[model samples]
Structures are given as structure tokens and as C-alpha cells.
Target: MNEESRTNIGTPVPDASNPEEVREQVERTRDELGRTVEALAAKADVKAQAKEKTAAAKEQASEKAALMADQLRAKAEQATQLVKDKTPDPVLEKTAQAAAHVRETATRAGQYAAERAPDPLLENAGKAASFARANRNQLLAGGALLAAFLLVRRGRGRR
Candidate 1:
């Protein structure tokens, strides 16, 4: 084709002089149109847009939950410190002694149970104890928080 007749890059103009060239151009235009239609249809799809929004919301919610968990852990530590500060040293020592006695009793009971309990029960108890040991810090913090809350409530009632 002459440079004068050509337009938009090397794309040929549809003319009667070359039927084959016109056919090729028509096919190319149809392919381009089909792709454009598909892009528009995808943009118009409600379900796909909804799914994208839901994924973004879930990611945001997960981030917020992680942040909240960290804050809660910090607060638990502070509550535990406050409890330790308020308690008398003699009371603390007595509490520790009582805890040791309880531990000794538990050890003897566990030994007796090991001798007579079924294998499945012992296995489950072992798993529970393992989990408790692994999460001892968290457990202690929780217990301290509960104790602080109860003390606050009792003090308020006395007033």
C-alpha cells in the first residue's frame, strides 16, 4: 500500500483495490473488539469485585487482630506488675510456700494415677500438662489479671 493511503502505524485501510488486505484488517479489528469487550465485561462483573473487596477487608481485620493481641499482652504484664507491687512480702512468701505444697500433692496424685489410669487418659493428661507448661507465662498473666480484677471489685464493695 502507498504511504498516503496507510494510517496508524502499518495498519492498512480497508479498500476495494485489495480484498485480501481488507479481509485481514477486518479479522484484526474483530479480534481487537473482542478483547475490548472481554475487558469491559470483566470490569462489570459484580461477583469478582465483591470477592476482591472481601479479601482486602479480611487482610485488614487480620492486621487489627494482631495489633490488639499485642496490646492485650502488654496490658496483662502491667496488671501482673501492679498486683506484685500491692501485695505484702509476707503474703507473697506464704503464697509461694502454699504453691509448693500444692505441687508436691499434685506430683503424688499424678504418680498414683499413672499406676492405675488407662493409657488413653494418661496420654491426654500428659498432652494437657505439656501445653500448660509451654504457655505458663500467658497462663500466669491471665491468672494475675483475674486476681487484680477480683481485688478491685472487692475493694469497691467495701467502700
Candidate 2:
């Protein structure tokens, strides 16, 4: 509301007979039309709008990734703290020693079993293994058939 433009706001249209006034009016109309076109053009800028949407999506993804990373870190820290609290150094050492003992025992038992097998028994086992390998598909199908028959027989027995 400047005093000057305020007066122009209510100014009546000049007579069409005046060439200069008509020209000025047309120029003003052209300026207003250009401004309207510019506004519409800005609104209709699909590439810019798409870029804005993509940036927003990327920002959201980054925020989510950061949040997930923070949660994972917190969970890992909590798990570490819980493990530290529940298992003292002596307990951990004993657990490790127990695991090693079990592993060693299993290895010794396997070795003993292998050593105690008779030559005939080992040879028979090897021949069976070779045969099974050569007829893997047939063996699998036969095993499946046997399993199905057993299941059916058991079901009948139950009734």
C-alpha cells in the first residue's frame, strides 16, 4: 500500500481511441501474463520436483540407516555387557577348558573306532560307500520309498 501504486489500483481504463493508453495497457497485460506463465512453469517443473523427491528419499534412507546402526551398536554393547556380567573370567576359562577336553575326547574316540575296525569290516564299508556313491539317485529314491512304507505301516499299527 504505497500511496502512489494505491492510486493506480483503482484507476479506470482509458478509452480505446487513445493509442498510447491502449499500448501501455497491453504492455501491462503482457507483463502480468508473463508472470503467470513463469509461476505455472515453476509449478510444472517435473525434473526439479523429481530431484526434490529423490533427495528427500535419500535423506530418509540415510536417517534410517543411521538409526539402525545406532540400535545395532547398542544391542552389541548390551550383549557384551551381559556376557561379561554372567560369565566371570574363571567361568569362561573353565568353559573353554571343557570344550577343549570334549573335542579331544571325540577325536580320540574316532581314532580308536577307526583303528579297532577289522580289515574285512573296513573293506566292506568301503565297497558299500562306493556303491552308494555310484547309485546315489537310485539309493535316495529307494530310501524315500522305504520311509513312506514304514510311516504307512506305523500309522496302520496305531489304528
Candidate 1 lDDT over residue span 69-102, tens digit each: 9999899778778777877665556556655786
Global local distance difference test of model 1: 0.80
lDDT of 1 at 23: 87
Which regions of candidate 2 are displaced past 4 Å?
1-35, 95-159
Model 1 weakest 10-residue run by lDDT: 140-149
What TM-score does candidate 1 get on C-alpha atoms?
0.63
Per-residue alpha-carbon lDDT of model 2 for 84-158, expressed as tens digits? 465546555555565568669966875786799888877887787689678654544344344445656887999
**Candidate 1 all-Cα RMSD:** 6.7
Candidate number of the best lDDT: 1
